[model samples]
Target: MDIFELDSAFVLHTYARRKIAFERGENATLFDQNGDDYIDFASGIGVNSVGHGNGRLAAAIADQASKIIHSSNLYTIAIQARLAERVVRLSGLDARVFFANSGAEANEGAIKLARKYGQNSGRFEIITLRNSFHGRTIATLKATGQEKFHARFGPFPDGFVYAADTEDVLRKIGGRTAAAMVELVQGEGGVLPLDEEAVRNLAAELKKRDILLIADEVQTGVFRSGEFTASIGYSIEPDIFTLAKGLGGGVPIGAVVTTKKELFEYGDHASTFGGNFLSARAAYTVLEILEEIKNSGKLARTIGYFARKNGEISAKYPRLFLGEAGVGLMRALIAKDDLIQQAVLERAHKERVLVLRSGGSRVRMLPPLTISKEEIDLGFQRLDSACRAADF
Candidate 1:
């Protein structure tokens, strides 16, 4: 049986699998079994920040694995300690770190921390935005605002309330509210960025009530938005934030950073594979690469160039494209219609460019930060071809 046949026979039908299967990848491109190269604009949904097959990352992982891996949290691991220090320093927050294996787990940890912190105050409810996407776990699913993710997954855990406006948020924050979690840039909800002033105002209000502010930066963290974290650009300092997608470049890793260490007791949370040596090495290497990118000013230049090209594309294809949303490399091209968006994405894939969709109608592009200007131009050309092909 071929790859598709094998997948059909054994794999669970959870995801709508794409037609192509990638075999290998290297620096902003992936090769299929047929040896066709496709420019990766999705970047594994914003996980491959350091690009594919990075030699430095691979060497670091190999070196750490050779020495030791999978040391439990019961013992002190050198690499874990080092990585945590680096994270705390770069975050510009005096916080302790708890590692997990994915974004959902990180959010879960943050939720637990918030509830524990509010335990004495009789507060357990978490207020989230109406269109925000949190995670897939039972608790995180409850924390998510969209009803589509809640289908057939009931009964969900209690204490999750969706608020649309500031008044609604304030109304929901009576005695039971423990925290208010938000995604500064709602990646899955049509690449919508929250209004900075509104977020700050809400944060200040929540603070007066002693409500914790949890920023879900799962998709927007790790310099994906040309900053280490999107919260920094927004000028809102959340009490806690969850990170995962781009932290380990391609390796599975997640983290919850909080300003207060007293929020979580020792036995409150833990993860077996969270900060193992191999993953830690990969994450540390990613941070190092990001530092280099910052110092060389490549990240800033690339982001600026992409932003200009995005504007040009929007202007060039006025009929098909409505406009652009989002910040830095994490951007989206809003289509005039959902059908046009889907058609454009399909056509782009056929033209050897891989892009993504957000909220059904926005063409999401999260190319690796290390992507070259030439590669960005190529991607834009392919997208342009797609727009022309799918023109009504």
Candidate 2:
């Protein structure tokens, strides 16, 4: 049997698998088994920060693996320690770090930390924004705001609430509220970004009530949002921040960082493969590349160029395009409806550019940060072709 038949036979049908099966990738592009090239605007759903097959990242992983890979967290690992220090230093927050395997696990860790911090105070509730996407784990699923993901997955743990307005969030923060979790850019929610002023004001209010603010930077961190963290650009100093997706380039790694070390005590939480040497080396290399990009000012220039091109696309096709919103590489093009959005994505795929959908009517674009001007232009041309070919 071929790859598709093999997948259909054995794999669980959780995702609506795309037609093309990618065999290999190079910076900003993926190649299928047939050797057809597709410009990767999705960037593995915002995980490949430095792009595919980065030599430095590969060398780091190989070098670390040749020496040692998994030295359980029980002992002090040198690379892990160095990564923790780098994260704390670059975060501009006095915090401790706990590593995990994915975004869901990081959010799960953050939830546990919040619940423990508020256990004595009788505050166990977590308030998340309406339409926000957290994760797939039981705890993180409960923390998510959308009901579609909750189908048949119950009985969900209590103390989770959804709020749309700031006043509503404030009202929900009564005695039972432990923390308020937010995504600076709600990537899955149509790539929506919260207003800077609103986030700052909300953080201040949560501070007064002693409610921990958890920023889910799973999709928006690591220079995907122009800054190291979107919270930094928004000026919202969250008490706890969860990171994953792009932290280890293509490697699986997640982290929960907190300003308060007292929130987590011994035996409260741990992960076996969290900060293993291999993943730590990948993450460390990614951070180094990010620092170089920032220092060279290429990140800022690329972000500006992308935003301008998105604006041009929206302006050129006002009848079908609603608008665009988001920060840095985490952007979306709003279609007139879900049908139009689907049509555009399908056409774009045929045009050899890989994009993704956000919410119902948003075409999400999360291209690699290291993408070049020529690649960006090519992606834009393909997207334009898609827009023209789409029926609606």
**Which regions of candidate 2 fall more than 4 Å away from where they truly are?**
none
User: Residues 28-137, candidate 2, lDDT per residue (tens digit)?
Assistant: 98899999998999999999999998889999999998999998999998999999999988889999999999999999999998898889989899999888999999
| Residue 340 C-alpha lDDT in model 2 | 86
Q: Residues 1-392, candidate 1, lDDT per residue (tens digit)?
A: 98899999999999998878899898898999899999989999999998888889889988888899887889888888999999888889988899999999999999998889889988989999898899999999988899999999899889999999555787788788999999988999888888888888998898888999999999999998788899889888889999999999989999999997887886889888998888888999999999889779999999999888888888888888888877878999989989888888899998999999898499999999999888898888887888788885
Q: What lDDT does model 1 reach?
A: 0.89
lDDT of 2 at 122: 90
